[model samples]
Target: MNVMVAEHIGFCFGVMRALNIAKKTKERTDKPVFTLGPLIHNPQAVHELEELGIHPINSLDEAPGGILIIRSHGVPPDVIEKAKEKGFEIVDATCPFVKRVQEYARKLCEEGYRVIVVGEENHPEVIGIIGHTGGKAEAMNKRRIPVIEDRDRIGMVAQTTQSIENLKLAISYVVERVKELKVYNTICNATYMRQQSTKLLAKEVDLMLVVGGKMSANTSRLVEIARNEGCETYHIETKEDIDPAWFSGKITVGVASGTSTPDWVIKDVVEYIKNL
Candidate 1:
């Protein structure tokens, strides 16, 4: 069997930046360094950071002092404020694209337009964006936009990882409901390229393997996109999750990974496929 891998198969710019910041902090200080959440969605990456003395804690209350690295997903302004109040040194590692969305949401709210964030309601990125809007914005995953008040103006921004298809559908639903609508395409360039590459690969290969953490929203979306293209796709975090039997009768296969995925994980999975 022949195997192909997506051209963009590992950590994107934002994830790389966040990891570098964490690693640099570890190099300089003996103090406890805690991340607001998993530095990135990949478990292996987070585990690697832990080995270097960087820890992931869910709440600010749990971190007593030292440096706090905000995850790539970014946190609300208030989260940073609270951390500062507690005397923790802050490393803002929020993806620049996500920060753009938050700023757009805040601008829309200030301009008197009802803001709508187009993405998973429970996603940290979406929640962070909403916090920028002072917790008054609405978050909708698909077409389930809430009944709007008598507001005529509406502004929409998407979670940085959302697929264009999902963003467009959400916008279509809101377009009919509001009179004056503003839409900002906040999906990062890296994400858009990865989605396109994954879709293209799926059509050319007999089977597809998407590698990344299950908790990664973007990784799950890649699997969904491959399946939606009618290709047999499996989402796996590591080479151990691969089933040799799945490769039976397949002449060609393709591998793609989420932005948070590390280069070593992809190389291992690809090597395993070649050895099979």
Candidate 2:
């Protein structure tokens, strides 16, 4: 069997910047270093940071006083203020793309538009973006377009990892129902590249393998895209998740990974496939 890898796979600029900030913070601080959340979506990467003395904490109460690194997903401005009030040093590692979305949401809210965040409601990034709107904004997916009255003016911003198709669909749903609509295309360029590359590769391969953390939204999006292309696709975090049975009678295997995925993880998956 032959192996084909997507042109755009593995860590993007934002994830790399966050990882570097975490590592440097660890090197500089003796006070326990803790990320407000997993520094990135990848468990393996977070585990590696723990080994280097950087830990992930879900809440500020978990640490009495320590350096708090904001994950790439970005947190609410209030979160940073609270961490400061608790005497924790702050290292903001939020992705620039996500930061832009939050800013746009805040601006939209300040301008009196009914803010609609186009993304998963429960996602940390979406939560942070809503917070920027001072809790006035609502998050919605393609399946759940929020109710907008004909008199309501709507302002929209999407999760950086959101698919373009879903964003477009949500916009279409809102435009006809509202008095006016303003949208900021906040999806990351890297996300578009990765999704497009995965789609192209999936069309030419017999089997498609997506590697990244299970909780990674971008990774899951790739799996959805590949499956929609009618290719047999499996999402895995590591080589251990690979099943030889899936490769039976397969000629060409395509490999794609989320932006949070490290190069080493992708290399390991590719090596395992070559051996198989």
Task: Name the candidate that leads on TM-score.
Answer: 2
Cα lDDT computed for each candidate against the true fold: 0.92, 0.93
Q: How would you encode candidate 2's per-residue C-alpha lDDT over 1-276 as one tens digit per residue?
A: 799999999899999999999999888878999999898899999899989999999999999998999988998889999999999999999999899999999999999999999899989999999999889999989667677899999999999998888899998889888769999999999999999999999999999999999999999999999999999999999999999999999999999999999999999999999999
* Model 1, residue 139: C-alpha shift (Å): 0.8
lDDT of 1 by residue, 1-276 (tens): 699998777999999999999999889998899999899999999999999999999998997989999988988899999999999999899988889999999999999988888888888999899999989889988545677654678888888889999999888877877678999999999998999999999999999999999999999999999999999999999999999999999999999999999999999999999999
Clashing pairs in 2: none
- Note each model's CA RMSD in angstroms: 1.2, 0.9
Evaluated at residue 201, the lDDT of candidate 2 is 98
